[model samples]
Target: MTTTATAGADAVVVGAGHNGLVAANLLADAGWDILVLEATQAPGGAVRSAEVTAPGYLSDLYSSFYPLGYASPVLRGLDLDRYGLTWTHAPDVLAHLLPDGRAAVVNRDVDTTAASLEAFAPGDGDRWRHAYADWREVAEPMLDTITTPFPPVRGGLTLLRRLRVSGALRLARRLVVPVRKLGDELFDGDGGPALLAGCALHTDLSPEEAGSGVYGWLLAMLGQQVGWPVPVGGSQKITDALVARLVARGGRIDYGARVDRVLTARGRAMGVRTVGGATWRARRAVLADIPAPALFLDLVGAAALPPRLVEDLAHFKWDGSTLKVDWALSAPVPWKNRAVAAAGTVHLGADLDGLTTYSAALARGEVPRDPFLLVGQMSVADPSHSPPGTESLWSYTHLPFRRHWRAEEIAGHVERMEEVLEEAAPGFRSLIVGRHVAGPADLEQGDPSLVGGAVGGGTAAAYQQLFLRPIPGLGRADTPVDRLFLASSSAHPGGGVHGAPGANAARAALARDRALTGELYAGVIGAAHRAVYR
Candidate 1:
């Protein structure tokens, strides 16, 4: 590897994931010289793609859907279409299959989606429509609030103004309730509840978990507005577009430059030293797009962190691991419900009870016999992903983090997943032209940020969300270390393709550059810390 003795930049960003790229772009746009160092030869991290199964088939190795990506204020502000990024939406957004040959389909049209739920039961359509109408009123402000800095004073005030004090309190109560309980109270049929429950499965949370209702509600509402769109080519197009935009703005990225330590002086980050014996000096700030544990313990070193933070890091809980599989199919998936074929995504497993069992099994450190699968029919969503008449499809399931799966065990799990799919779509196995399976270990090997395959940065439990994310202190992007920022998904708002963490980090870094503003914001955050952690 080529190594430079020393380099200087206004800001040094560790890792070139989407978050890191966002930081680099924003800083560069501000006329600051930026340098992004990625450990891998290529950037994008988990948001990557390749022909894993067959030569002509394009498969997204990790993330595929972009409901959050589309709704993200930071991303929407960037005219990515000029940089060769286009979105493709399927005829339907998502479908959750049931054992009874019925499906709960989510469509871009609220009325149509409600109709699908109404078919399962009489009054569910009206209930869904009513809920969706309420969502529309507060959706924009809610997105702004969650995706903004901690405390969200401005966004919170806006929400309060929109809904009076009692209404705002009621909304908060609804957000904290478990999806299962909310579903039971709102809808009489299984279709609406099952659909919401399946959305909850995207996280490590079970339907019975309190904060899980928020994730389910958010994704479902975003689907109605954005339709779970994908890139026209593949997921890598997103990374490519970001890289292009960053480079155009005078940002520089060095591949295969793994940071070994964050250089500090007088309690402030100065620069970074790489494993390859090169140093990159940061004149302004250092932003880490890595996991929190790796940032504090490994790179910054435990000796540099506060004892209390070190303790918190030791006890930090991670979400469950993941098992992903991609297939190159000779024909489309033979779904029992043909309408499912028109959808971009599918959820398979048992009903709500089965989903609860799956979550319980993960918590118990045991693999579920019937794993819940999140399936992506890439070719169905974007035909350019594969050759004509063929399909490029992928699916992923959650597993217990403690389970150390061997090669044989991994194969067994893959077979079991195939069986589950076959049960839903008969003869699915016969259509497979080639296949690739990635267990939890493989996921980590591909991207260290996905520690133990915990994709959402860390467990997004009720106690670990919002103000308590990554730790129970102030949830701002600024760290205890001066001039150092945590710009990874491990920060507040956690994971997904949304660039909120990066944007928040950038704002913090920019604030620090202006001393008065930084001091004022710091005081506000300190007060919030006392209010929340006290």
Candidate 2:
């Protein structure tokens, strides 16, 4: 109800998550006045850290490792290290522990990782090395292609030049292959295959799902190249560094200012009104860094959206809900296999078939009795996470999306998860000095963007990726409403710590400011939207 006329900025970012912050910083760097509105009390949306389990123990609230963040050119180009962001890594990147004593570890050293794989099956080490080498050939251009705007202009052109005709077709075919198939085709043993499948689980995709192979291969290779680094102090260090960089560039942030509605005039976004009745106007553009459903249905309103968009939204599938447990351990986890202790991340409770069964259970809307867990050994990765000789640990598992979660179910799932961990590491429960549990509702309460505890914005399934992301429309940041952009994980290139969505939104906004070509480009984009949405 209160309009602050003087509180006008060239651009207004609707959320202070990493994507929103990244967008704001890029806009600020261009000498534009930027104002970021965050619903939470802090900037980091899910990329936050706190001592939830006990004092002197730091735990990553949502996301911990940063392979994507490190490999992202948009983030790397910012040089956040100068702003106090220090990355630390463990001896190994990740480990996949099977029910048996065997462990598949991905080490920073490719030869070491190969050797581990070779143990599972003969000549598997050489096969892994070959796959890694093939990855190296297209890694740079592929990374560029995925993180840049849709159509990938420069990155795509460069990739075509690097791998002409047959090579390009081969890579394209591999990208669409199922993770299960990729593993079977590439590795002779369960070791390398299990490692890739576990990495693929990082997304909502099952090992049997199409497009899961790309995620598995990409993440596993990134682990080899970047070692799944984490901030020295906590995940908050990354947020602090980004905030510092944005602030130094004259950008401003307003926390606890939940934007309820995006104000529009003549079909263009002009500002946003917060829940507290304060209106903040945007002189040029408004970029929404929240989830697609929330931005389209709640803030923008269904009446304002096209009927087709609304219909498509009705069919929009969220990834999956989650259940997480954090523990402040009195001592390190007593793993039966000592190799797992050297890695920052550990995947447990599933093999390839088990992973398929888990995914199937989710599709059936039933919680799997045996959930596959993605666990983080914080203290192992960074010694500063807890008191000397102690450990800070956390694990999360995906569940089927539901309207509500009962407390009893949450507790039951937590127990099941711990039992899995206990089996892998005997006496693990005895080491827990304190513990914290976050169910689907608990996670959503902390961050609204994590709707139903779906972390990756939306499902990473083949039917919902690339040009089909969010909906059947242009894969660019521009929206149906002029001057409004989707800068969230729901956009093209999908989710990760990478700042592609935000960077693409910023670039789109900047393109609209050019003198002569700007108007023409807008007309063309506007036409395209009408054709698609109609």
Candidate 3:
């Protein structure tokens, strides 16, 4: 049943997710012949959209907002707007609502955001302005360091020069501090703390975690700087643009071609074999836009890997599973706090203690009685998402990971989530004309890379970040096997649709393929792999 192709391209990219498309595009730009193979019929992995709720109601299936995408140097360099990608934003960025009806809102306008924070507690406005000013000083270099390849020598030096050693160390300490502690240190009263805690929960990180402060500070600042914007039509438009750019560069993508085996000979990736028994060789390299576990254990097989690598992978951790519900509504949500209506993204949790309790329950493997929800009103952000006068809405909450979620269990959880929503916006459940729910299994089934509905590739824990990400090795895209690179969120700089992982992979592949330095590149990478893996 297996068929073999006579011709092989310079490189074979194992998935057509945004990361793979990005890697393929960069390689194609380098003038290398590239072929990308995808398991699903669609190009976008989780960055997709559909009308699952009702006709004329468009819902973003997985990720909807894109503050990171808008600011990403990798995405910006591509200039995807030329390929029919248009971005639009809601009037306000995000609002965090409390049960008492007090809300802390973040807007692109600094004055508006400062005034909103000041309403909850006096003098917080000046504190916010001070924080924003501090952020502006290190913003460019900080962002650059994050998006570049690991051991970001160039970016690190620039940042160090800007802040000096003592100042840099102080900033590092602030970032590593717990979100709860950081908020307590930086602001007075509950308003500022609630906003930071809500933003930290964007990842699986609890406010109590060591590295949680970074995510909280980074996202809240980005919300102010860029505003969380969405593609004009849908999230799928982002994917479509990446695809169009790749095709324009003569890169090829084969949908429905599931790569099951990475063919290796003499410890180098030679080609890949698909599930349907087709063999496609890679003349130069093979890049995988799949999870680390899938690439090392499932596709390559354990027998071919080093004992240390196999052991390291065993310690890898995935983030929490999630439950997402989409609703097609007859009218906009009637929020008790009218200001919430103006925002594209809303975070609904009573307060800091409520968030702590919810996160603690998830840590203990129990579904919290009160769920902290991240809600999106697509119609508010883009009118085309729904019919006139109606709304397209969706919200997602994290759950303990499970392979299977019973229908009744899902229904019960959905009911609990809706109850929380109704608390903030009275009569929220009444407007639903149609609804669709996706549990962990549904997300994985739609895109296998989203293992257990762990959207951020893996846990963004301090122990698993930077050089230690995916596994302890050179933090670059190079893998144990020569001519192979990890081009997925599982690599360093994990997750977000920034395409850094793919960009890093493409650069590595291109460097190894260079005529003069090819042998030297292989020698250095091989030594590093042996030192760590052997």
Each model's C-alpha lDDT? 0.88, 0.91, 0.91
Q: How many backbone clashes does every candidate have?
A: 0, 0, 0
lDDT of 1 by residue, 380-433 (tens): 999999999989999999998853678887888899999989998999999999
Better of 1 and 3 by TM-score: 3
lDDT of 2: 0.91
lDDT of 2 by residue, 1-534 (tens): 555544789999999999999999999999999999999899888899999999999999999999999889999988999999999998899999987778999999999999999999999999999999898988899999999888888877877898898888999999999999999999988988899999999888888888999999999999988789999999898889899999999999989999999998888998999986788899889999999999999999988888999899888889999888999999998999998998899999988899999989998999999999999999999999999999999999999987499999999999999999999999999999899999988888898899989998999998887878888889889988888999999998888888899998999998977778888878989999899999
RMSD of each: 2.0, 1.0, 1.0
Candidate 3 ranges beyond 4 A from true positions: 1-3
After the best TM-score superposition of candidate 1, give how far the Cα of residue 33 lies from its true spot, in angstroms.
Answer: 0.5
- lDDT for model 3, on a 0 to 1 scale? 0.91
TM-score of 1: 0.97
Q: Which of candidates 1 and 2 reaches a greater TM-score?
A: 2
Worst 10 residues of 3 by lDDT: 1-10
Question: With candidate 1 superimposed using the best TM-score fit, by how many Å does residue 446's alpha carbon deviate from the native?
Answer: 1.2
The TM-scores, one per candidate, come to 0.97, 0.99, 0.99
